[model samples]
Target: MVARQFIVRHDDDDHHIEHDTDDGFEVLQSQIFSLTLVPPDQQKILANVNDAAINADSDLAAVSDRLVLVSVQDQREISISDEELARLLQAEEEAVYLQQFQASGNRREFENRVRTYVPQVFLYEDPMRQEAARKTVPVDEIEEKSLIFLAKETSGHQTMKKAMPSYWSYSLGSKNLSGGTSGMGMGVPLPSEIQYGGSRVELYWCNKCSKETRFPRYNDPIKLLETRRGRCGEWANCFTLYCRTFGYSSRLILDFTDHVWTECYSHLLGRWMHLDPCEGEYDKPLLYEKGWNKKLNYVIAISKEGVYDVTKRYTRNWHKVIRRRNITTEADISAVLSDITSECRRSFSREITSTLKIRDERETEELETNVHIPVGDSLSLPGRQSGSKEWRMARAELGSSDQNNSEQRHKDEYVDSHVTRIHAAFSHLTSRISKEGVKAIKKLLEDLRASPFRERTAVLESQGIPHLGDLLEAISLKGSVRPDGRVSVGLAGDPVLTSLALPVALDVVEKIINKGGNSD
Candidate 1:
């Protein structure tokens, strides 16, 4: 009838606590019993200030500002492993999300909805089945009885695990040469076939009359199961579903730089393991960046439980990735992802939510720490494991097998891209600017070219031209194009900018400082 509270600590657990009021003091004892396993009769609910038994809410209030309960049954605390608690919390959260999901959706549309939510990233692979089976099946079945046969079939054996990487890499299925392909649609696609992205287009070479058409990238796992084919997108999509179907808590990892993979909780290893089904690679996070020389800007992981930004997990050189990360502000990205994750757990208990928060922070610490690890040359770093040689070469996704050739070029690409941006936007100044200014600018370019990529990168980030109007801000030279197709630049009062210098150059520089406009 009356609301009350207590800060209860039992078994020396730092984080876990119990405090609630129900029917009476007896009910509170039952609550403590549930957590500490000390019978209500043996437990002593006492106030910290005076060790007095808290018989009633008034007695608890008399002891201190807040009530305190402690089990005096045994001299020692109860045994509760962190692992056991985490697994319990995770399962509880899953049930909440699943419950909310079931209350609102049609089973037939579940797979399609996942694709619509995250067109390119969602993993919704379901095997081919009859209409009755498809309509009747649910995720609950997979969650409950997934391992009854799947593990025994493909992944359970240690030898099969080793053979799997090579099989999926080379034998699973060949890459679809026509990327922008939609397979063999004799006529235009129906409304139901229209995908979220423009990826379902009829290719130029795909003659509908001939029926020899581009195969559209399939999202259905059952179809992928039969075909056993596709790019990394298909591989990860299908593989993640395999993991989920096998009862492993899995995530579909999407690299914005055109790659996808899987991460599943490895109870044997006590952590999540990276998996590239297309490459037949396992536990090699750096295989893409270090092995294939990928310039990753973003990597995100999505699962039924939550969404996570996992970019640092794949990248060794965080600075380079940061420079390329212009898609959105980092804060906005975090806020949006956190909002989505929070929405999924809106109905979850506060204790479960707290555990998730701790897990999120711990995962972040792990991923960020990984960002600093020195890039290593692993023997497992083979070039472009999945797709054909031609496709791999076309994508330039070679691994360490070709690292010797690409190592230097990789550095040059970084330096050149920045230097080229400088040239494209500011090179015109050489002709219109004063001779002294032109000489100084050319000197910097020469120095930048000769210096190491790291040095050049530092110089770019420090003061290089990010745009047409902001060239060499640290050096006091600025330029902007005029609205009427004219170039204007500013050279700080230097010897070349005297009465003796070209009047045209001075006029151009003055106009740039005065009226900033678009480039020609």
Candidate 2:
């Protein structure tokens, strides 16, 4: 048999007319049937439908003597079944549509399309369960799944929302009282009260109320709120969930020494800021080593994005941290990071992957160059750079203000403790200006006189007393102080308590009458 070629053009392009080649014609026919070429004109190509008649054609017979019949579409040079042709056309249309979308400037639109290819990551509260799931997934799939997990909006609620301004102000102002729940009332407090509350009152409440459980629980924020508290690990876990619920990108940072906190990504600042719910502190990475005097080893931050060894942020000196770090080699860390990042990026399109890779490189550069280091000069510290006199004075003022707050906090605690002690001793005393009340008032007066002007103010404010006038009014003209601290207008004609308490009452009254004017 001799090879034959056929010239074919279904569109404007010139056709390569192969005059005498069997293989070329077969390939060309196959291309047409595969939808590479527009289907040939039906009137010209299908002269005869019967196999014998098609085999009789000189051009068709040269390629294949069998000359099996094939279906052709009218719109294109396609010799395939109708269903297959329709699918190929739809696929082509979709490809073009995606190309157009990707070329457009809308990053969100492109991201939406890219997400279809990524597998959904269902992260659990349990780390062991999460590790099991992680093992089941390919390394390349981790990043995309992580991104989805980070931004997962379940039931239209964001897990990582930015916190309110009041919260920030309160967090920044309040002192880090690591333990004790004294002075923090159970009732919901005003925003200003939290700022001026003098301690981590919420953490106090959590510690006091939450039942101690032997089994570990990485409770969500809602559950923690309901239960009122947990261990340090649970506190950090819940706090992280709270940040995420508010639409903030937060990571759960775990220290080998059994401490956990959160690192939130600040979009405005374009970096992670350390936040500790237990301490009521933010952006204080060095607090662990410098303030708490902790000896840390591995500090890992695990987020949906990936797992990162963030020990460098807390440790100022690399040599010291390296010695302490339990990880055998830096190469292992790098390998783990690479595997996680690759898994996260697995489902991303080339463009998105490239963009993220570049961004990651920039972040790595920033992390390496900007890790906090100790400064010899106090004034040379980051954010407190030596500058104009005005700047120096402002820094000094801030330092002074913090010191003053601390001092006032201690004084307020003293008064509160004394008052609480009195309450404890005279548990059945109903009236604030009774014999027992009078004695308590006398003790408070003696303490208040020794206290600086600020402590007096703090006691008044903290105790819900409006002014010194009210206190003075209660001392002189009262039968007894009311539950609300108001003085009764009339004098007490009857003595309810035994004579033993009468002297304490009279003594308290005499001291208040003489010292009320000098109290300020």
Candidate 3:
């Protein structure tokens, strides 16, 4: 006897396991186990072997050993070999490294970096994919039953009758029941099988669509429904509003010259489809510019997402379009577009992924590049001039605002009317106040400080700054300084008015000072 040490192990059940065995004894034990393993069980053991064969040779054995260990643990009692345990850990580490490599090579990050080379001015906001996903909800799909009813009601209108497609009448008259909701309780009349020409004439209805007939006093959809006669703009606005009521992503596209139309997101097409309600046309994007032979310089599309200058879509020739778009220079238009796109990205649905955003930006860049032409020393054709002091100041205010308020201006007729009234008053006051001298404007400011908040905003809103620089200089010269760094001017009796007016006054002064300093 040689001095030899033997080791023993026990599981939770207190079953002993032998260790420190020679190759000869272990082989004999394996032979005995193999003899007991039936053909059915051998298939289970070989399944892991087949799985390992598909992997690379370096990790193949390690993976197979791990699978064998797992199968053994599940099927029968067995002690794990130390070599197999080490191989299993090696395989896991290799797997983790491979995953990290794959994650680090994300295509999205690469695409984003590529997009950085393109100018921000060239980027645009697009929400087609997001709008498509939103269409999955029942509420998002427009009740065609409502459209059918509206078409029938407006079909007799001479202008609308010409515009209405024959299929619309057939679709409504015939029992083609696809894509229509249950109109039973919705107050919508059922489709009539009896086909009839649109020959009905009501006393209030116009024999021919006139300019006066189109401008409805009320532009709401409900009101439009009651009154079947409206202008192209009104019809478009009402149609867009109705589409929105049914949960469709809709926008009112305005051609700065005069025309208006609706753009509704089409889930079937996976993009926005132009719908001219007045004309009863769908997806006819070029109908205005091409069909009507209209010269369009600017086509603005306003939606809840944001405002967009979609002139490129309407104008194929950039050089010709830029000549007509002389009201705003290229630089100014670029600034406005950038402001609008940024605002949309901030406020649009969160589901809009970065990949889609980048794709939209690339498309915009292509459009911009195609249309861009250098004017150099040559000026564009003379259009509407906005060089007056008040117009210039308003332009400055619009540019200075954090977000472009152009969309806000076109949100509704109510807001537009208020703005128009305010603008007119502002123009009058600016001219009179400047002629009367800065002293007269300073007196008006002193009166405003003591007024209430409502009165202060009313005056500011009504009488915009006549000469921002002169007004601010007069205030700083006439008003007393407070401890809090605000000028103590305006109505001393009303604290809210004084508080509101002082900040606004100071902000105007700072902007004027900055503007002058920048020029110098």
lDDT of all predictions: 0.52, 0.43, 0.40
Better of 1 and 3 by lDDT: 1
Question: Residue-wise lDDT of candidate 1 within 1-520, one digit each (tens)?
Answer: 3344455755565223344434556656666655654555456666667766677554432345343555443333334467755564465455444444333323323223233435333344333323322343343333222232232233332321342322232322124333332333344554444442224533333223332433345666555555554567767776666566556777888777877788886543324668777766677788887778788876877876667888888875665566565544455466667776776678889998896676577578667555554543433465665655667888887764765544654675345332343344443543344444444444443443343322231122122223434444322344445555434444433312111122233333444544542242
Deviation in Å, model 2, residue 380 alpha carbon: 13
Q: Count the backbone clashes (under 3 Å) in each candidate.
A: 12, 25, 7
Q: Which stretches of candidate 3 lie over 4 Å from their true place?
A: 1-216, 267-270, 340-356, 362-520
Error of 2 at 213 (Å): 7.3
Where is model 2 more than 4 Å wrong at Cα? 1-222, 349-355, 377-520
Tell me the tens digit of each residue's lDDT in model 2 across 1-520: 4544333334433233433334433344444433322222221232223433332234643443222334342333223467754564465455444544333344443233223212211132345434443343333333323333333322111122223111221111123333323333334444543432212223233244443212113133333343333445555655565555445667778777657777886543335778766555567787666544456666777765556677768865544555553333454455655666577667778997775565456456555544432323231112211123354355342232334445655685445432343333332222334444444455554443443321221122123333323344333222345677643332222211111122333344565445542232
- Candidates 1 and 3 compared by TM-score, better number: 1
Better model by lDDT: candidate 1 vs candidate 2: 1
List TM-score per model, in order: 0.45, 0.36, 0.31
Q: Would you give me the overall lDDT of model 1? A: 0.52
- Writing each residue's lDDT as its tens digit, candidate 3 over 1-520 gives 1221221111211112222223332322233233332111122322144543221123222222222211121233224466755564465455444544434334343233223312211111124323432333233112222332233342212222233322212111113334332222212222221111112211222223311111123333343344444456446755565556446766678776667787765432233556676656555555554444457777766665545566676554444555565444444455655565565568556566464465356436534542332222222121111223354355332132213223443463234332344344333334434323333343455455444433342123223333544444332322444455444433334333234234344343333434442221
* Candidate 3 structure, TM-score to reference: 0.31
Identify the candidate with maximal lDDT. Answer: 1
